[model samples]
Every structure is written in structure tokens, then in C-alpha cells.
Target: MTRSTWRTRIGFILAAVGSAVGIGNIWRFPWLTAENGGAAFLTVYLLLVVGVGVPGLIGEFVIGRRSNRNPVGAFDELAGRWFRPLGAVALLASTVILSFYSVVGGWILRYTAASTTGAYFTAPQEYFAAIDYGLGAVGFHVLFLAMTVAIVYLGVERGIEVSTTVMVPGIVLLFGALAVWASTLPGAGGGYDFYLSLDVAYLRENLFSVLPAAAGQALFTLSVGAGTMLTYSSYLGEDRSLAADGTLIAVLNTAIGVLAGLVIFPLLFSLGVSPGQGGPGALFVSLAGAFAELPYSRLVGVVFFGVVLLAALSSAISILEVLVAYLVDEHGLSRERATLGTGGLFLVTGSIAALSPAVFALLADTLANVVLTAGLLGFLLFDGWVLGRLAREEYARGAGPIARLFELPWYYAIAVVLPVFLAFTLVTGVGGILGIGISTRGAAAVAVLGVGGAILALRRHGVPG
Candidate 1:
């Protein structure tokens, strides 16, 4: 039996965008901005999106489209046996990500239900604190993971393509509508200024602190370097241009991220909910509070959490796909077995995160960044070093003359600059996570030289993808 592919280009792009634009954008984006100097973080994030995210997006596609295999096989097929370790690492990273991601998805689903039931009417934050702990969140996490397993086990055509096509448009429409509605609220202007204004001094002082975050968001938001992109691209039929598809996905994801900020900040500001202080609960508690105090409040709560549920589900599907593909490819497990096995693992791991705020905070912040950045470093190395020649050729295939011109720059960036940047980010992000933010200068020194050492090691091996 042949692997199923997307029936249309629109389906492909929408599915990619669906995975890219999710809880990461809504819940995480606003929070990260609040943590890392609001507007300053946004500026650097935008810069990295174009620089790091887009190329990494193309690189994943090249590997996937070229081999027409799942992520593990794709690298092994092109970059030889040595590259398989990196492929395995990407596979593991996705599984780790999904374990936590699905729990968050569950939180969204519960909030959506609560919104409909008017649960946020009295003490929104307190309500969140009560429900978002221990057995409650664990139960919800299991349910969310089960839903993800069911859809992904159905395979790409019915599972990913159809689901994303429907949900992606719905999410976009809902957020846009929410933004318009939020704009009418009293304090919406303050929210807009806070979110969109440029802060040059803040940017200069905290560029390094924010760099890893923006890069991680770019990577996480795009679902790039996670092997999900590679898995999705593996189904490509070559009738579509890889460059064009990647660009559309990146643009849509970025647009949605900005759109989410527009919707969230306005609502929170309008309610006098200091977005800076809200943490992960802010999007839920803050917005729920806003709805409670506003006219026709119940309707807005339904709309907001409904949008989040859709976004969360879409992204969860991508996360589930990673483990599913890896199991089916590497271990020769059936889709059903793989999803079950993966879900079973997450059941325990996610419970830990659910029960402990410390762990969840770590996963959501520094730890997630470290793992993802490290994984991307491994991925870019596999592409640039191990799969170097084949990546160039694959990137050129079905590419327009205009996009083809970017091949060398893409190569150098992924091959040289990105790995160093990733290394710096890995250390710096870890440092901050460990309460060592003041040591960024020392971290920067290591990031510079260590990444170079990685490139030299690759050169010594003469890896050729």
C-alpha cells in the first residue's frame, strides 16, 4: 500500500499552517512577549522568523519531498546511516513536545467547556487554579491525547488534511472576529500600543535574553525542525513548489501569531488585566474575566476558547504525527500500536507536568527551548553537513528561478550560522531556566565557539546529505 498524500495544494498548505498556528501562538506568544520585554521581543522574533524559521522550513521540506519517506527514513535515505541518529533525535523531540503540548490542549478544551457553562463568572484565576491541577488536568490530558491518536491513526488524507482544512479557516475567522470585537473595548488602545510599539532601549539591552525565545517560538510555531514538517512534506507529490508552499505556511503562521496578539492583548488590556502578570493562565483567566465583565459576555467566552480548542487540536495532530511516523518507519509498528504506545508514555509524563507547576513552567519555557534548539541544531547539521549535496539539489527541484537564487545563502545559514546560533540559544536558554540570566555574556562566548566546533566536527566527518 502506498502512503497517502494531500489531495490538493491548498490542503497541504492549510494543514501546515494549522500545525504552525496554535496554542504556541495564542497562549505562549503573549506570555513570552510579556516575559521578554513586549515590543522588543516582537522585533527580534520577526527578524528570526525571516532569518532562521523560513530556511529551516525549506530545509525540512527538501528532505521530506526528496525522499518521500517519514522523517527518519528521509534522512537515512539521503544522508546515509550516520544521519539516522539525528533523525531519531528529531523523532524523540517531537514525542517530548507532544507529551506536554497535549496537556495544554486539554486545558484549552476544558476552558472552552467552562466558557460555555459560565464557569469563569466568579474568580476566574482561582477557578483556573483549582481545575488546572493534579488529577483534573491529567484526565483532560488523556482525553486530548486519545482524540489526537484517533485522528492520526486514520492516516494523512482523512486525519491531517481534512481536519486541518476545516479547523484552520475556522481558527482564522474566529481570531479575526475576536480582534475586531476586542478593539471596541475601552482599554484596547493601550493593549495595541503595548504589544506593537517598538522599544529600542529594551531591544538593545535584552536582545540576547529574547533571542533564544524568539527563535524557539519561530521554530515551535512553524513546527519546523521537529520532524513533523518533514513527515508532512514527505507526502508531497512534487506538483507543488516547495518554496512557495513553505512561504505560504510561514506567512500564514506569522500572520496568525500577530493576529492572536491583537486579539489577546486588546481583550486583556480592556479588562485591565495586566498581560505581563497573567502567565499562561492570562489568556484564559484574563480573557474569561474580560468576558464576564463585558456585555454579552458568555458569547465571547465561547468564541475565545472555541478558537483555542481548534488551534490546539490542529497543532496536537502534528505532534501526534511525529511519533506515529517514527514508530511506523523505524520500529515497523502499526499506526494503532504507535499511537497507543506514544499516548501511553505521555499519560505518565504529562501527568507530572500537570500536577506540578514548576515542571509545566519549565517545559513551557527554558526546558522546551533547550530541547527544541538542541534538536534543531542536530537537524540543521544533518541537512547542511550530512545531506548537504542532496539538500541543494532537492531545494532546487520544482523551485522557481527567483527562489532558486536563495540556495547558497540558505546553505550557509543552515550549515554555519544557524548551528552556532542554536548552540548559543541552547546554553543561554538553559542558563535563564537555571536562574543564571546574568551570565549571558559568558554563554554568548560559548555559543560562538562551541557551534564552530560543531561545524568542524561535521567537516571532519565530511558528511554529505
Candidate 2:
């Protein structure tokens, strides 16, 4: 049987942008920005996005298009079966992401409906706590999962491409309109100050502490290290300059995330709400409370949460697609069958997250970050050390001269420097999770020494650089 392929370059790019632009952009980016000193964190994040994230994205595109296989099969085909576990790690990241992601999507969907009905407006905090776990959460999760599975069942081009092409543009338009409207609100200037103002003192004092978050957010915002990019690129029918596509996706995703910040921060400040105060539930609790007090509360609530629902559903489609593609491409299951099977798996796993706040926190905060960092690290090492010269050739296949000029440096960065940087991030993230109390400098030193020793061992083992 023939494999599935994306119908057009624009379609593929739109789908990738849809995957990248998600709840992370809307909820997490602004929170991180507010917590880490706004413009200062944004500056470091943009640098990392360019320096680390884009190259990592293109690396996945190269591997996927080169092998034309799902993550596991791609590694099995390109690097032999011995490296398939690396691909499995990518698959694991996707599953871990979507399990909690779908539960969050369910929450967004509930908020979207509640906005019109004024269900949560009476007592937003209590309402959120009441519905955050147990049977209600599970039922809502199943509803969200059903919508996701239905789309994936329609196959790649018909379902994913078509849906994102519409959804991505809608996300931009709605959020853009919201930002414009938000700027006109009374006391909105304070929100913009909180969002865009530079805090050199805060940044200088906490640069090292913030670096880990900035790096992780760069990866999370771009949807790297999760196999979603690889699976999307595997459907490509032609070389359309992986470098160009990766850059466009990064820029669009970043723009949307920033725009979301514009909408979120101004509204919060206008209503005197503190950003990032409530953890992952911050968006639901704080924003819902904001909507409750505003004039035209119903309209604002519906539009805001509705846009969020669209963003959540679009991202859920991509994450779920990763495992579905694995089943179809590697196991020869029909698309419908594969989607159903994956949905069933998530039916149980996602319910666990929806039913337990602790499990949801574990998956979303600790497990998701560690797995995504580890997955991207594997892909970069494979591109730099394993694919090496061939990876560059793949990158250059349809790239213009301007794009091709960065090929050599891109290869070296991905091969050596990025792996070390990502290793330090992985270490710091694990330390944060385990309460290990390792200093950022200590983590950096350990990561560099570890990479150097690994390079020497690989050289002695006759592995190609």
C-alpha cells in the first residue's frame, strides 16, 4: 500500500503551525514571561528559538523526510533497529504530552460552554475545583478525545491539513481581535508594562534560574522533541526547503504566542489579576474570574474560551496523530483502526490525569519537560553524529543559497553545542522535579564534561562524527 503524503507545502506548514500554536502559547508563555521578567525572558527565549529550536525542528524534518517513516520506523530504517528505542522515546513523549493535553482540552471545552451559560461565573474558584477531577472530568475528557479521534480518522491531508488551514488562521484572527480590543480597555497600560517592560535588575539577578525555563519554553512552544514534527514531515511528498519551513513555523508560532500574551496580560492587569499565580490552572481560574467582572462578560468569555478551545483541539489533533501514524505506518493498521486504538489507550490514561490533580501535574510539568528534552537531545545527536554529512545534504536538497549558507554551522551546533545545552536543561529540569537543588553552573559543568567524554568514547569506538 502507498503511504500518506501532505497535499501541499502550505498545508504542511499550516499544520505544523497549528501544532506549535496551542495552550502553551496561550496560557504558559505569558505566565512564564510574567514570572521570569517579561522582556528579558523574551529576549533569551527568542535567541534560544533561533539558536536551538529551529535547528532542532529542521533536524526532525530532515530525518522524517529522508526516511519517510514514523518515528520508530524512521530510526529503524535510517539508523538501524538498535536506535529504534530513541524513536520510542519520541513516541513516549507524544503520548505523555497528549494524555494530559487532552484533559486540559476537556477543561477548555468545558470553560467554553460554561462561558455562555454563566456556570462558573458565580464562584470561579470553587467551580474549577469541583469539576477538576472525578467523573465529570472523565466524561468531558472522553468528549474531547472523541473529537480528536474523529479528525485523525479522516486521514492526514483531509483531516489535519484542512482543519489546521482553517483553525490556524482563525486562531490568529480571534486572538488578534482580542488583543486590539484589550488594548482599548481601562488600565490596560499597566498590563502591557507588566508584559513588555524590561527588568534588567530582575534579569541580572536571576538569569541562570530563568535560562532553564527559557530553553524548555523554546522547545515546548515550537513543539519539538515530541515526534509530532517528525510525523508531520514524514508525510511530505517533496523537498520544500526544510530550513525555510522550520523558520516560518518558528516565526508564526512565536508571533501567535506573543499575541496571546498581549491578549492575556492586558486583560489580567485591567482586571487587577496577577499572572502565573495559580499554576497550570491559572488561565482557567484567573481569566475566568476576569471575564466574570467585565462588562459584556458573556461575549468576552465565549470568544476567549472558544478561541482557546479551537487552539487546544488543533494541538490535540497533531499530538494524537503521532501515535496513530506509528500504528498505520509501522503496524499496517487502517487509519480508523489506528486512531480508535490510540484513543482507547488515551481513554484510560487521560482519565487518570483528569481524575487526579497530582498525576496531571506530574505528566504536564515534570514528565512532559523531561521526555521532550530527552527526545530532542536524541534527534540532535542522531543528526549531528549519526546522519552527519547526509543530514546537510538533505537540508540542502531544496534550500536556496541563503538558506544553504548556514548548513555547516547548523550541523556543528546541532551535533556538539546543542546536545550539551539540552543536556544541561534536562539535568536542571530533572533536578527541579526531584528537588535535587543542583546549581545551574554545576549542571552546566557536568553536562559539558559528559558530552566531551561521550565524544571521546564514540571516536575511540570508530563512530563517525
Candidate 3:
């Protein structure tokens, strides 16, 4: 079977942006920002996105476009069987993310439909509590998974590229309109102050506490740590600047995320609702109540959730495509068989997540961040050590002079600095999740030791640097 490639450059960009601009941005970003000192969190997150996220993104892109293979095959072919497990880690990260991600997608789907009839307007909190877990959640998850499978079944160009080309623009345009309208709401200025006004003293005092959450959100929002970007880039047939494309995707995703905050914060503030109240349920519970009280309640609710649905679907498609591409490339399955098989697997996993709140929280809140961070750590290590100069060569390919200037610095950052930072974040993330106390020095020691051991192991395996 012949491999599929993106039909156009813009198609590729839109699809990549679609993958990045998803539930992570629309739902989770605001919730996280609110929970982690608002503007203080945003400040750390933006710095990390530029410093760590972009280089990490290009690492995946270089591996993907250079090999033109799924994550597994790319590693297997590029490095050796020794590195195949690294790729498998990325594949697992994708499966883990979309399992819970589909459940959230299902929620968005349900909310979008219910918004049409003002179903949740009467009692938003109670409605969410009732439907958050159970057979209804499972059914909706299946429905959302089915929609994703249909698109992947249609092949890359006709389905993902075409759909995201429309969806990305729609998300941006609709979000722009919502933001504009949100600015007009009375007391909306408070929302702007809370979100946009940085508290330097708070950040200085709480930088360590804020780093893990900000780093995780940065990875999550950029779609970097998972193989989603790698899988998407594997469909590229052209020689273009990976740095430029990766930067653009990150910028677009960040812009949309900030725009979502613009829409969400003001609406929450205007309604006298605290943004940080419900944790993961904040977006639905808080926003649903706000929509109900607003003029044209049903219309507002539908549009908001509908945009969320589109974002969710776009991201779910990229994640599902990772598995589909793996099956087709590595197992020699047809696209249709690969997609259906992947969908079947997710149906079981997503249903489990939906039916069990503990399972959902485990996947969404804890495991997703840890796995994505670890997965990107592996990619950067492989890029810096195993791929070495080949990685640099691939990065510089088709890059413009401006992009070329940063190639050496980018290489060192991905190879050394970013890996150390990711390892530290990963340690902090795991310790936080498991209720363990890890001092910053302890975490740094662990990160250095971990990276050093990996390097020695690669050298022992006769891997070239």
C-alpha cells in the first residue's frame, strides 16, 4: 500500500493547528490558568512554550518528516530496534490521551446538542453531575469516537486536511467574535485584569510551585509531547522549514488559547462565577450557568459548545491517526482496517474512562501529563544523541536564512537544556501526583542522573552521536 501525504502546505498547517487547538486549549488551559495564579501561570507557560515547546515540536517534526513514517517505524528505521521502545512510548501516550480525551469530546458533543434545547440551562451543575459518568457518557464517547474514525477512514487528504482547513479557521473566527462580545459584557474588565495582569511578586514567590503545571500545560497545548505532531508531519511530502511550520502551529495554538481565555474569563466574571471552582468540570458547569443567564441563552450555549466540539474532534482525529498510521505502516493493514481497529480499541478504553470517574481522572489529570512529558524526553534524547548531526541536517533542510541562524542553538537546547528541564518537570509531576515531596535540588539531581544514564546506554549500544 502506498503511504498518504498532505495535499497542500496549508492543508498540513491547518491540520497541525487543528490538532494543537483542542480541548486542551478551550477547556483545560483556562481551568489550569485559573487554578495556578492566573496571569502568573500564563507568564511561565508562554516562556516555556517558546523555550521548551517549540524545540520539542521541531524534534518530532524532524523525525517524522525525515522518515515519513509513523512514530514507531520512524524510530525503528532511523535509530535501530533499540530505540523502537521510545517510539512505542509515544504511541502509548497518544492512546492514553485520546482515551480520556474522547470522553471529554463526548461531553462537548452532548453539551452542544443539549445547548440547542436549553437542557442544561435550568441546573447546569446538576446536569453535569448526572451525565458526567455512566452509560450516557459511554454512548456519547462511542458517538464521538465514531465521528473520528470516519474521518481517518477517508484517508488523510480528503478527511483530516479538508476538515481541519475549515475547522481551524472557524474556531479562530468564532472565537474572535466571542471575545469581542465578551469584552462588551459589564464587569468584564475584572476578568481582563485577572488574566492579563501579571503579578510579579506572586510569580517570584511561587515559581517552583507553578513550574510543573505551566510546563504540562505548555506541552499539552502545543500537542508536542504526544506523537500527534509526529504522525501529522509524517504525512508531509514537501521539503519545507520545520522550524517555521512548528513555530506557526505553536503561535496559532497559543493565540487561540489566549482567545479562549478572553472569552471564558469575562463571561465567568460577568456572571459572578469564580473561574476556578470546579477543577476539570469548571468549563462545563461554570460556562453553562453563564450561558443560561445570558441573553439568547440557547444560541450562546450552542455556539460555545459547538466550537468546543470542533476543537475536540480535530484533536481526536490527530491522536486516532497516530494509531491508524502505526497499524497501516508497521502492521501492513489497510487504512480502513487500521482505522476501525484503532477505533475499536479506543471504544473499549474510552468507555472505561467514561464509566469510571477514577479512571477518567487518572488518565486525564495525571497519566496524560507524565506520559507526554516522558515521551517528549525520549524524542529529544534520541534527536540530540542518536540522530545527532542527522537531526540537525533534517532541521536545516528547506529552512530560510532566518530560521537557519538558530539551528545550532536549537540543537543544543533540544539535546541538553530541554531534556534536563523536561526530566525535572516529569519528576515534579510524578511526585505531585503520587503525594511525594521532591525538593527542587532532588529533582534536578534525578534529571541529570537520568539523562546521563540514557546517554551512556546509547553509547553502549553503539549508537552514534
lDDT of each: 0.81, 0.85, 0.89
Candidates in order, TM-scores: namely: 0.95, 0.94, 0.97
What are the clash counts of all predictions, listed in order? 4, 0, 0
Q: Candidate 2 on 1-465: residue-level lDDT in tens?
A: 688889988899989998999887887777678777778888888899989999999999988998999899998888677678878998899999898888888888889888887888877767888888788899889999999999999988889889888888888998888788788878789878877787889888887668877887888888899899999998886659999999999999999988987877787776666765556666777678767777889888888888788788788899898898889888999989999999999999999999899999888767887898889988988887777788888999989888999999899989899999999988887887778988868999989887777555434532353
Write down the RMSD of all candidates, one decimal each.
1.9, 2.1, 1.4
Clashing pairs in 3: none
CA shift of 129, model 2, Å: 3.2
| Candidate 1 residue lDDT tens string, 200-280 | 988887777888889888888989877889989988887667877888899999999998889888877877778777787
Residue lDDT tens for model 3, 178-280: 8998899898998899899999998988886789888888888888878889988887765789999999999999999999899888977887778777677
Instruction: Estimate candidate 1's RMSD in Å.
Output: 1.9
Model 3 accuracy (lDDT, Cα): 0.89
Top candidate (TM-score): 3
Model 1: residue 79 alpha-carbon error in angstroms: 2.6
